[model samples]
Target: MNAPARIADFVINSNADDLAQQITLLAGQINAATHRLLKLIAEFDTCKGWSGGGTVRTCAHWLNWQCGIALGAAREKVRVAHRLEELPLIDAAFEKGEISYSKVRAMTRVATAENEDYLLMIARHGTASHMEKLVGKFDRVQRQRTDRQHDKEQENARKLVYYQNDDGMWVIHAKLPPEAGEQVIKALEAVVAPIQEERQRELQESCSTDAHGDVSAETFSATVEHEKRESGNHFQELLEHTRADALVKITEHFLATSAGGTSLQALKGAERCQIMLHVDIDTLQRNGSTHAPNPHCREFEHQQWLSPDTARRLSCDASLVTLCRYHHRLLHQGSFSIEAVRDEGHDSPALRFISAAGATIETSFFPQFPGVSAETSPLALQRLAPDVDATTSCPYWTGEHMDYGMAVDGLLRRTQ
Candidate 1:
């Protein structure tokens, strides 16, 4: 049918379902046409049709100017066009109108000949949003793995060296990871920036003429002092001298505070930043194998999984909070009961765990030294473990011993 006749008929007779079907059919046709257009663009790019003796920088630039496509979208089209030439399966799917341009665009970003079939399968089954999310996650995983490897290399290469040169001047050189280097730079700038600004203001003020159209006596004196200071190799020497003085001040402050001479509140730039890690107890204690699912370590901030060794290194100077997987599983499986307790003598509420056999476990907190809770008496301890006498004193064993090893082995031995 002719274009006008089909439109007139559609306007007169179309129902909702018919309109939906026609829209779907037209979308398919548009996709097929777009596939052909991309094919032409690829061929044109190969022939350097838009190069025009280097007048145009790229085919995407030409498209943006002549075809009125947005520059970013034009670049994406060009990239997808070139990529499709290499992936025959995706190219055929695009030509057959089985997938839209959006899916092709996303797949081409992370696709290779080895993975093209898998990507095509996903494009066939998943929506554009799914494809976008999959691509994003894949990029993040790849980037994180790369970053971890790079960080390890940087850490191994870190060092600080100092020596006295032949001129009796102390020289220092340091190599640090990005985060540490940034902290050092910030500390130096924090100390030096104000001094630099003050110097700049003095220079501006001393050079300015007074309101009476002549330099004031104070200004002239200040200018003469400034000139005397700037007599030879002025700007660079002054800057280096100021930085050296700031460095000395910073070192003195650090030594004073570290030696307990005076306790100054931490400066904003000197505050420590903590990295949160989620790791299983077994992995943390034993440096267990990462291949095991139960002992895996993950970084909370970046959502990246880390190796056991890295987790241990991070935990060296860190405050630890542990959750045992085995105990958690047992708790979930109805092996124990936990409840909040707030007695008349207690200052704060605490969690109490009771075994299935009605034996109360230790309380979460012990404010004062009632070594063992009244609920868990020596008789109850003997009832739980008949082999060991509850009255026997062990140096490492105490009612208030909250260490993980003691809790897991000594205190919870009866439960196991």
Candidate 2:
């Protein structure tokens, strides 16, 4: 650790002269941000209820809820308010009315911390006319290397991966349209039901004929040959000849012990029509890896306060937000969200949230797993959100020079 840094942490925590302004700014900024963000959180959860909590409607409903004006006016209000959440000193400055409504919106929406900070500083210290000048400077600074990365990510996400296979089949490997699910279920039922019924009838007739007056083996063989020689046969018919247990075993063998040459892209887009469901904060962070394990996934969701289990729980049937195999880690240590659903106080913690198109999903914070719940009182679970941190002084550097000191780097390490 550097000498100045070790001392700076001390000063920052204690309000030494150089850090006095920064400490004041940090605390006030955090407070101001808390109110605005809390409103956003409430709005998000509220829209979750009122908007049927789908992807599109939650955002639209939230915009409507925030504005309380006409739809167009409310949109503008939401746009402005969300933009203001980006400003460096926005909450505190807005609280004090140092900047006008229009200026706050313009300044906050510029899309970079550095530019926002610089422009906010200039406007605070410069004339009203200086807003344009500050914005211009901010733009120029943003085109530099650092600011370009976020723009690149957004652009990359837009460029989806889509292609067609050799069989003249369409492949949309990304998130599937949730709209087609019912048709799919109906189609599957149509295809499978007759075969299943046929299997039951054949099994019954074979046993019945053998039970009293036996049918000749020649007749049974003739029926089998006729089925095998039928003009059109789908895999489902062949599957009926094999019992469900045998089908499962054979399919597993076909997949796992298949020729190594297979790329297995058939599994890629099949889960797309399934929905992504989730529980609220208390359950999300404590659960597994189905949600945001990386930055991009995190941002597309809430980005903040997301846990892998929470994300995975939400994306249970989702092909788009595919959770890795080891996603069960979200509940390894016993998370609070899993408990809250079972709390005696909760009348019915289980809920079904539907999308705008009427795609319904059943979600329960309290899953029916055998050993887990509020009743079980599992290990080391923090039920309420962790307390707002009181400031603490680290003494890692006091003993001697060290690499990176005791300050943790990386989000995973910090969380773990």
Minimal lDDT window, size 10, model 2: 387-396
Best by TM-score: 1
lDDT of 1 by residue, 1-416 (tens): 89999998777676765766655555555566677789889999999887543335689987875566788899999999999989999998777666778888998987777677776766676667666777766655545668886688688879999987778798988999999999888888899999988985776565877664566678766775777676757777887888888887787777546644556644334234546677644445444446344422222333456677888888877766433655666677676767877655445455667776666754322223235453534354334333332211112222342233332232123322
TM-score of 1: 0.37
Q: Where does model 2 exceed 4 Å of error?
A: 1-50, 53-56, 65-88, 110-118, 125-129, 144-416
Error of 1 at 381 (Å): 85
Steric clash pairs (candidate 1): none
lDDT of each: 0.66, 0.45
> The CA-based lDDT of model 2 is what?
0.45
Q: How close is each model in CA RMSD to the real structure?
A: 32.6, 26.4
